[model samples]
Target: MGFDEKAQNKAQEFQGKAKEFVGDKTGDENLQADGAADQAESGAKKAAENVKDAAKNLKDGLTGN
Candidate 1:
């Protein structure tokens, strides 16, 4: 994935971790769930980007790039 996309995903993942930590310390179930969802979304985005990169690499290889 591109640098911008990777950085954004990392930021999101970090934010989620922070949220989870705060929620756990404060005993906020909803916030904890939200944090988990955010982390999952970030993970999904990263996975999709990885797949796209892999496909691009495969195409470039076949084309002798």
Candidate 2:
């Protein structure tokens, strides 16, 4: 099956949240930082996806989708 970018991003976001929670519970500073970084990366990817689709839509509009 083709990879779903949205699903991937959501999964990453969820994972980051879980890690952040676990790290906080365990008092692991490194894990918490990693989780925060992961969350940022996932958010950036989602934003990129939004930009990509918007560009595609603009192209389609110009060409008639």
Backbone Cα, N, C clashes tallied per candidate:
0, 0
TM-score of each candidate structure, all chains considered together: 0.90, 0.83
Give the per-residue lDDT digits (tens) of candidate 1, residues 1-65.
67997899999999998898899999999989888888999999989988998999999999999
Worst 10 residues of 2 by lDDT: 1-10
Best lDDT among the predictions, by candidate number: 1
- Any runs in candidate 1 off by more than 4 Å, and if so which? none
Deviation in Å, model 2, residue 58 alpha carbon: 0.9
The residue pairs that clash in candidate 2, if any, are none
lDDT, model 2, position 33:
90
- Candidate 2 lDDT, 1-65, residue by residue in tens: 12686787888999999999999999999999989999999988877877988999999999999
Candidate 1, overall lDDT? 0.92
